[model samples]
Target chain A: MNLLLSSFSSLTNKVLMALAGLFLVTFLGVHLGINLLLLNNDGGRAFTAAASFMGTNSIIKVFEIVLFAGFLLHIILGMMVSGQNKAARPSTYVVSNHSATAPFSKYMFHTGIIVFLFLLLHFFDFYFIKIGLVAPPDGIASHDFYSRTLLLFSTPWYSLLYIVCFVALGIHLNHAIQSAFQTLGLNHSKYMDAVKVIGSVYSLLITVGFSIVPLFILFYRH
Target chain B: MNFTLKIWRQKNAVAKGEMVTYAVSEISPDSSFFEMLDALNQQLITSGGDPVAFDHDCREGICGTCSLYINGRPHGPLKGVTTCQLHMRSFKDGDTIHIEPWRAKAFPIIRDLIVDRSALDKIIQAGGYVSVHTGGVPDANTIPVPHEKAESAMDAAACIGCGACVAACSNAAAMLFVGAKVSHLALLPQGKVEAAKRVQKMVACMDELGFGNCSNTYACEAECPKGISVVNIARMNRQFLAANLLSEREKVVNISL
Candidate 1:
């Protein structure tokens, strides 16, 4: 019975956490490449082609279901884990600060919230419109979705929002990426340092890469 | 240096507690926090009040008994230190310092600041020992650990079984304490035979004690008086995951064969 419980517990949360986290990290690399298309002119031929392929691809649809499950599982497990944490230490923290603590620990829930909002915006954006889940709001043409993304960037506020969200994504990735490997028992310092650098670079690329789309459309869109 | 203290006092474990105020005048700034508390107790005796009860031993910081949440920080806002080593000089004249026991469900307070930290002792008992037989001492060099490995082992061994890591953790997880114990044993040649069993046992004990899981918050490392590394926690994870997988695979192989 104990073995059963332990095995189940490990598989449900810890194992899923690792798998989802690694899967999401892959999405960062691919998504970054796709996002870089905003650098193109002529109302986003590159953007539309990539968007259509992603939208119509049968394999991506299956992955999309998995992605959705992964997102919910990750968020739910994160909360359960945090809640368990709060229950264990019911006492209040008195330290004004602890530098030895990782920066990720403090802003965990906050970053999770920001990332969730970013996903919602992204879904309403390409997922909903591109896939026909819902027509683009404000009579925005389907082909003009790229231009819509560009025009949204025309407002500094919209650009600022994406930049801020991406920054949060970067911070979240900084801790999450390497943390996944640690969970998977990859703790050797020789290799872990390389993982940290990879995680940091990947996080930076995705965040900065996605944020740049807004800046490009805001500045260079003709 | 005279000082006023707001100490958290509870009649018993069943009762809810609050910060009952006390004044300890003419305190020597050089005296450790526990010594300052001793002075306050002396005054309490004279005034016909209950002496404040807190845990301590060895006056040195090694015992991990003197856990305090000074001001708003564990072990008094200082880094890489414990409550016993904390001096009155850390506080100023007329400062309203808050004192409380380690706050956790697993560590029930017996009275005042004295908590039943045997939960930690229980964790150690689960996997903290080696299975040595009754025999004469082996040769000094019979099992020689490499310098680097021995040093690393010693680093983990530096843990004094203190529950400060639990207090410092937002989740009140005992991962650092458990990690320290696991790393100390798992790295040495003497401990390899039992590494898998030790980690599985210790981690199970920790979880059973109602301590939370590790989230790599690294708070335990920060508040630890020994500055026990978060790397130790990672090491512990590696040990546990590898042990479970290896043991499981062995069982499967045996069954198949």
Candidate 2:
């Protein structure tokens, strides 16, 4: 493993980072699908049943470990790559112009940092409770993510922060999906434009899909 | 036209650099950017001052010898043309232009607005070549290259090895330059013989040269005087990944043996 890592070039590092990030992208889709069950109007029964299955399933336990590893690799590689990139230019131009590229491309690291902070909050809210780290709110079962999610979203401030983080995640994904395709060399001239469009649409869907739950809970559930 | 120029001035590679402002007047708008610089240099010589040192060879823009970061844009504000081809008409009278050297760890500044671009040549020396027997030149259409392949190869071949891509990239990455070099040759039959080895060696060299990783900003493509597309970068990525995978698999086989 050490020999393999030592032999990997900068391009290889980027490829690995892109692969990890794409995995996380797919994971977000699964997470959103499960979370959408919160709105089944069945008083948390459907959502809790699905959440309980995910928590207790043996396969999902293995997948959870893989998911953590993916996040760790993505974050570590992202920081290393960005640090080296910064060091590559010892000096900066007095007048810098980046008008030629997408405005959000240069800010991926910034948005990544924001999303990371939000992840800490999210894990504290839910993952910690699942593992008996933090006690579930009064009278709610430790495994009952459904009531916990609604309880948290019912707070106006918490819902607002959740929506804000989703926006940041959306911005990050707007560049990340297409960038991963480019990094992986899957981009072709004939289809690159289409890939870019798909990336935008996918990001928009994730942002809106996740934000709707909080908005629906705060407005309708209350 | 008259203008104020804030040009970086460095005596040598080890010397500290600073932006020194100068004024030039009564310049024709039709004069090339180099002509304007020449006028300024002439004035400096007559006034007992050191003339600014800038690189230039062919005034027609093909020779990639000239490099300047003018008013924050590589090769001046014009697209698809080198500094030698940029005219003074692009700027208005009394405009204040900022001129600086290409800033990259790989391409260190040699003097004011001039950097040592031998790093690019080193990458080329790594593998950007095709091995053919020394004999009479082959017939033109012997390989029977597809029209699309030839056209795309030509597009990639248009890169002039100017470090503008490095200058324009926020990370100062040379992926575009290396990608163009790799793509032009890799697309042709003659180059396919060593495509795997070529990409591996060049990429290794690029990484060792302190260049940054590409983040897909496409700034290099936008600032490239030849209008080289980032698609060449994608091609290089594909080539590098495939080459590395094959070589790694070979390593596993060798270990088993």
Candidate 3:
């Protein structure tokens, strides 16, 4: 225990970061699935049903606790590692080259902060109302999650912010999935290419999947 | 070929350093990078000026002593070769090559382009050895090792500890250097007895020395003079995990008993 804690080995922090990141990846899929129900044109019926089920389900309630904990841990650890990385080089180079490093991967800290700020605004808009801290929009059912989403995305500025954040998410997820696997010691030359491919596809899916929603609301909301 | 050199200059460890530009002409294109530096130093001495200081030993690349950051790339633009092995032919006439010391918190500047890499020595002292009986060397075939495993271990063992990995890393991480050492020993049967303790101690020393965490940037593997693979880093991680679990199990058993 002393060795583990006292060492505070980068390996431990990295593995924990990767685990939390992968867990959050799963959460994104589920969250996106729930949010996509907004496209049901009949009404907010399907969205409301799904949101209500999630809001009321005991298992999901428990999972939400784990989800938030994972988020908190990942954010704190990411900052810690990033801070150390910065401190490791007290002096700046006059001419630095990073041709070997991935372009999108280099902006990890930037993308992470963008995604974090976006999460805060997103939670304030939706989760707060669902949890009763904030009131739902006028005349909409309290549990009509879809209508509330529509109300938020209907604002041009807000919809644009969502699109921008989803793009940042795409960049973050692109590097993160493969990075997590590499950190976990799951990398191999034979399959690393495949892992990177899967990462890009997954990132594209989540980014496009979530981005299309707000665009549809802004453009097609009749 | 003639060229201008922008070399980092510092009077002492505590002094602030800056790049000082110098010119050299009539340099033979076939000379090694250090030979070009030697010619410049001779000129500086003749002019009664302070000669630029740097580290080099056994002008052959194997010594791991000729550490240099030329034109923003460790060991210059070439791959899998140390600065000592880099010849002037790799550069063109009139190209101003920038030479700086390996920059990291653990590696402080001693003078000019020379840095104190003793911090890495401390990491090595922490575990980079197999404790065995002092006697006649054992027969090579005494320990039966799988061919592939032996080959992989040798590959890891090729790390020359040049600190180029630290200089090249975006995060200034030394994981590649430390990982190569750990995997090299951990793969061999002779090193198994102290494998767990070696990794733990080396890692503790590495963290304490102010090295950064590896973020999978892989700049270390790319800039490594020996071309040490990033796979060694993953192997080290696996070894660390197993060691920690084994130690934890042992502690639990002791307490229960």
What TM-score goes with each of the models? 0.89, 0.95, 0.94
lDDT of 3 by residue, B166-185 (tens): 99988888899999999899
User: What are the candidates' C-alpha RMSDs?
Assistant: 3.7, 2.8, 3.0
Alpha-carbon lDDT, every model: 0.79, 0.91, 0.88
Interface RMS for model 3:
1.3
Local accuracy of candidate 2 as per-residue lDDT tens digits, B158-216: 99999999999999999999999999999988898789999989999999999998999
The true-versus-predicted C-alpha distance at residue A121 of model 2, in Å, is: 1.0
Docking class of 1: medium
Best by TM-score: 2
Error of 2 at B2 (Å): 1.3
Error of 3 at B84 (Å): 1.2
Give Cα distance to truth, residue B109, candidate 3, Å: 0.5
Sorted on TM-score, best first, the list reads 2, 3, 1
Model 3: per-residue Cα lDDT at residue A167: 94
TM-score of chain B of 3: 0.94
What fraction of correct interface contacts does each candidate retain? 0.60, 0.76, 0.63
Model 2 native-contact share: 0.76
Off by over 4 Å in 3: A1-7, B134-141, B248-257
